[model samples]
Target: MTETPLAPPSARRSRSRGRSQSPRSNEPGQNLHLRVPYITRNIPTYDLLSEEALDRIEATAERILAEIGIEVRDDPEAVRLYREAGASVSDVSANAWRVKFEPGMVREILKTAPAEFTQCARNSANNVVIGGKASVFAPSYGSPFIMDIDGTRRYGTIADFENLVKLGQSSPWLHHSGGTICEPTDVPVNKRHLDMVYAHMRYSDRGFLGSITAPERAADSIEMCRILFGSGFVDNNCVIMGNFNTTSPLVLDGVTTQGIRTYAEAGQASIHLPFLLGGAVSPLTMAGSVAQCLAESMSSCALTQLVRPGAPTVLAGFLSSMSLRTGSPTFGTPEPALGSLVMGQLARRLQLPLRCAGNFSTSKMPDGQAMQQSMMSMMSAIQGGANYILHSAGFLDGLLSMSYEKFVMDTDMCGALHAYMKGMEVDEDALGFDALAQFGPGEHLFSTDHTLRHYETAYWDSALNDDQPWETWSEQGGIDAAQRANTRWKKILAEYEAPHMDEGIDEALKDYIARKKASMPDAWY
Candidate 1:
């Protein structure tokens, strides 16, 4: 993949509000080397459907939208926006407004969406170019529980949340700091966004996901970001992307639409995700489920365009299924795998960036089940041509829990996947036919310059996966992968140094959080 051109010099103006400029890690001349490598498209994508099949799915989705229609919940302004956009909206029931799209309206609104754009990082070096050939990976998100090496599983707190952000900052393979790494249950629901954004600002220089639990919370996120990146910069660039998940079986709730409105109006990025549980929330068949996903994702994305044309939006596919016997949600299944592949094709056709799940699992332990599930979801996402990958690590218990050990384990695997995606080089230097000719038959080239030159990066290495003899393993006490990962994570947190920031800016951010928390009433529900 080719590199995108840099933004113009005018886009790099310093913090210019009424106050003086503040110190930042990426303030103009400073350089930081913590930038990780984002995946680029280098191999062929997996095509599971024929052209005829894909066309059928698209037609089915349009038919679903134009006929049965989808509901927009408790948001008259959203209904009005759709009404004004030529959609037929009906409020025939309490808290429900059914919207029927005119034929081709979905595709028409999608025309204004960008095929590629940049999500700016505090440090310019860490900026991510989403869409096009870029494939960026973020850490696990929205898990409510935390797990440790002693088999401890419990509610997560603010301390646990900050530590996870630090871990993401330290990982060389993680691209984004993630959203809701683990919910800080100790904090009040209404005010947690302030603390969460503060943690991200203090511990991570990478770009981050925005709050979507409430529309007001989303506005607070933008306000805090304005303090960090300066008002002018935040307004003109996509610094934080919000994740807006629509309710399945054709419902768009008020909180979600408001969040979308807040971000879309500010020129920020938003991922229009629909969490589908096939055979339950949607159709059992992959094609039918994909068609539902298209209607849900495209319809919500079109709302963003209506709010503000040219707003950066992503088409997300988080379609999974449930076990027929127990009705328990399952991850890494074939249905979701096919859904991811088809999602990629559809996103490309609509000229928008795509987001897909990663390392998702139902396992409670970081064992074979966890690894298998993670590999299954991640492999399909990468090969399916996803532009942005969320939940790239630590997702467990069907995304209800986050495992520290599993996070480290998944990072190792993700790095390997990235290496594999960056297909082999075949230049004269890479071919090295001359070096092979020198070695001749049956002779060792271990002492040659070629071996020494490529030894550092010629092969992928595992941080925790063991491949030693029994005697060697015994000498190391035969500790399991989880134990090794636990030790590694502790070391990472201990050695992690937060990127530098201006003292004045840090104090101002603290003041803002304190005032914001005091302003809002404590809310639990």
Candidate 2:
């Protein structure tokens, strides 16, 4: 593994030259820290059921699996793995399975786990320590979507994987580059997994969340991270089994459970996200939907804790809307927005780091609707105190599409929220006691030394938004926020430079990936 190069003392000095303009005062940003001690809560006496009631819910889930079972049409390997794992199979068909995972088995898989994990960034300066803090950190880009360079449209593509990693590295608000950057349909399925992993390592040295594509792919992704960051090194901050989709009613599929165990044994964190579609798969009422979502999330968190006590895990609840008439997915709905707010508060009650979506737009373009929806949803999550906000950017149309302009806009929004979360400052200096004494009532402070010294530090600066008069705005480009965002994106892409890796490390990663590909059966790809 290549160690990150340290900056020379002179180089550090040069970077700090102009930084005194906004000196790090004895402020909360420097001194304050929020911690979430545990990931589970005592079952609320009201919500808690008698042992008999608990048995009923578990029995119902078991019956659903035995009768309905889950659909696994995409991967034959998944089918084989499930059958081998003792799941009942369908007659004649080799793909389907009726998996009945015992509740105890699920509990055993979650005990004795670590409480927090650390994620390394491209530069050692940006590494994020997750799980232990009051909030976990992850990047804005993830959803299965792609944005056009023209900043007008979006489509899905494998190139999104590379671009998202780049954006993740540049985002101070984001902590980890989530896995599954669009679907790599252009490449072979098995090869696509390795390709995405390689892209993340090359483009950004940040921690990643693993996908539930296939057990083999999941295992390979972890192994690749191990090779790059060293075994146990990557494990500390990485989430191995992420977004394990439950077959609603709270049953875990065999393949999903397999991925969870694989990561658990490797000593990596796991997150369970019960993705529910309200008004369709779940109840139409927001409270009812949230109740179900919370129950499912708790079940998974409890199971994870039972399997490995303190196994660093997150409670992720993504409750979105499903059109009743059309049955199509809907974004920008009040249900999800309200539900997410409640979920964040609930996670706080559990003393667990919560992962929810924020700054996500359902609009296909960077228009007023997009800004409105994104801001509304993001504020709800942040003010509600969501620990980790995922899919924070580049999303539209229910997370099925992306826009470069929208992504840049989201970056700006994220910066604003970060400033908001920092909250009001109260100190003798902030109170302007000396400045007040210098300039009495009705006197101007704008020209004062104190104001001149701290104005920039006192507030956030937005690159894409301006409140200038129409005459002045027209004299300039008179462009919309999206256009300004696009310009900023280009500037960042041109100027940003990642820290260099050691000699031959890049080639070693490529060669290792090629060798792994060669070892796999041809048909698998």
Candidate 3:
């Protein structure tokens, strides 16, 4: 906690002194303090459920935990830990241990989890304070396939991963570098976490997610973070966030439990959630699915407090509706969107931060369907007071692929939405009373002092959203948004200059990764 503030992106500082200090930007007009894209909710949150409905859902979740019980699978250590934490652990199945909580266990333990905590970044200016009125938009995670700029769909490689990271770093609206932007299939499964962590640390100074595939990977992520941001800094501040997904149908798998335990015990933050595919993971009804998800997420969140009281946790909703006709999972559906709004209300009732799926689409390409579907989900998150929006961009085809164009488009959407979230300034200056009087009827405001002063920041401008006359548009070759994004990404990569990192620290990271890869045999997953 005593770590120095992070200097602005433009401020060059001595890392040996301390990495946490924040310094003003060297740019004449730019404010160094305004380093990353972040939003603070100034308007009331959109509550979808009535009080009666919310009360009923909470009661049902408690009942589900008490009577229906949840299966804690495959981890004896977790089973034992749950028993020690006062949940009734049973011996019905070796692999699946049935755990039923006593009436007040979940609610009581929930008291220890914090509502808000600071998620530190390498550049202190980019550090995010999650929860409360804040919302941080991060890129997509866990997509094995990537759609390249040339419109080719291929398995992701380390190069593809680095490209995504660099794009994420340069993005003005993406606040966090999401873990597993695209799964690097080219890298060995066991050691990819190291490369991914290195990418996050080297390419971007922003905050990012930690590993969750296995406890060892999670441990490696934590250690690597400690090396990047001093040991004193990592232990005292939350430098990484691990998304601990709950297995659907009310099961806490071993890997998830390990991820939660290791991250919590290390004083890092986590998004505790359940991935629900309606009809497959849970019931088709909204009420039924919400109850199951709340029970599963809250139970594991409470478990985090048991492992380390006051650990920062985000209540999450990743419930996707199933396409009844095809029986495949669907995103941006009415059901999941409605469920997310209700989930936000539920998390608010508990006074905790909420995380949910964002910028999602079932489309394979960045077309009309993709844009519309993604906007629906993102609007839901913004309206619902979601504090941490995961998979916020680049997601497509039911989370199977990360698209280069979608990433750019979604970030543009995020910038506009964030501007919307700021709400209009209703004060006298903003009213433009003088401008109205001086300009009179038919007068121009473009050259007016008020217009010139605020014009640069009054509205959000898109790097890829074209607003050109027909003649100019035709002269520019008439490319679509995807094509424009393709052009932009390539330019950004060519001009990419990474955030500063000390040579010794960078070498240390390389050494650490080299040792890690050498010690383990490549097990391609």
lDDT of 3 at 445: 82
Question: Cα lDDT for residue 186, model 2?
Answer: 65
Off by over 4 Å in 1: 1-37
Model 2 misplacement above 4 A: 1-115, 120-123, 140-144, 149-155, 232-241, 302-309, 521-525
Q: Tens digits of per-residue lDDT for model 3 on 1-525? A: 223455332224434444443322212333222334467777788888899999999999999999988888778887887789888877767688899987778988898788888888877667787888888989999998999568589899999899998888876677888898889998888999999989988888888998899999999999988878878767778889998888788888889998889999998888888898889988889888999989999998887888889988888978888879999988987778888899999998898889986998999888899989998888888888899998888988888999988887887777677667777779988988877677788998888888887876666666677799988998989888889878777877787777768777889999999999999899997
Which regions of candidate 3 fall more than 4 Å away from where they truly are? 1-37
Q: Could you tell me how far off, in angstroms, the CA of residue 201 lies in candidate 2 after the best superposition? A: 1.3
Candidate 2 per-residue C-alpha lDDT over 1-525 given as tens digits, one digit per residue, 9 for 90 to 100: 113334322224334543211111112352122111111111121222344644554454344444554444334444555455454555334544343444343233334443444445433454445443334345554455566548434445567667666765665555556767566556676677788877766666555667566777778877866666555455454424355666564445557666655565565666777777776666777666666665555555544454345566767777778778898776666667877776665654455666776766667777889888877777666655665567677676667766667777776666665555555668878888878778788998888878987865677666568789999999997887777777776766665555345435567778878998898764434
lDDT of each: 0.83, 0.59, 0.83
RMSD of 2: 7.5
In angstroms, how far off is 142's CA in candidate 2? 5.2
TM-score of each: 0.93, 0.77, 0.93
